[model samples]
Target: MRKYRHLFRILYLILLLFVFVNLLLGFYGYAFTPLLWNPWLYLGAVTVFCHIWYRFYRNHAPNWQNLVSVLLSLFAMAILVFFIELFFSFDGHDLVTIHSEYYIKEKTIVFQRGSLLDAYDEYHELVNPFVMKKKIKKKVYID
Candidate 1:
């Protein structure tokens, strides 16, 4: 257990670093848009990484402590992200609702819910609907 401890420790540290960077990116904005990180995404990635680590790593088996730590961290990240969204939005609700669709003919995206948020691109990239509409108009006019 002692010999294999360092391996797990390194992985744990790397996971922490990844989470920290992701949070910062989400808070400030990602790819020129204010995007919130989804905790489930991180959780899935961590679980997959750990499974791979356990499979090929010598005689070392899965450790409950490691699993617990990872889950706890993920939960913490989820809560932090939830709060961050609240902090940014004027209302006490989510900054953006996750559901939306785009109409090519109208060149508009309509958000089903939330006053400030409206449709995202096909890639699920969120942007100000006003900006998106303007871009669509420009594109149509130029063509």
Candidate 2:
């Protein structure tokens, strides 16, 4: 049983990696924006929990360091991640809501929707329906 302790430790290390990456994905997914980080979408809680576990292992051990590591690691990761977002990343919510670009041939490209009212709002804000409307003038009687 003792020889397998090494095997168990190795497995624990692998698990830690999985958790860390999963958390990064989770945080980034929820973020769903372009930056040096934050993948630009909503990531689930499972992602966060898994990442917590991974970083938990890196700084802690079989000893009683888990509690201390968990607290500080979470704080550090949160601050670092948030700071990166604040200083570097775009507002993902905005990106997800509305976007526009022009092609060389004079066509504009726009995407406005998660398939809901928010989509319509984005379209209006970005696409300019008034400009897109057809123009016509009613004839008036001449005196």
TM-score between candidate 1 and the true structure: 0.29
User: How high is the lDDT of residue 36 in model 1?
Assistant: 21
Residue lDDT tens for model 1, 77-129: 66765565454332312223222122322434432222444422232233442
By lDDT, who's the top model here? 1
Q: Each prediction's Cα lDDT score?
A: 0.42, 0.36
Q: 24-128 in candidate 2: lDDT tens per residue?
A: 544543211121112322132234544557555665565557666666766776675556444322222422221222111122222222322322211111123
Prediction-by-prediction clash tally: 0, 7
Error of 2 at 86 (Å): 1.3
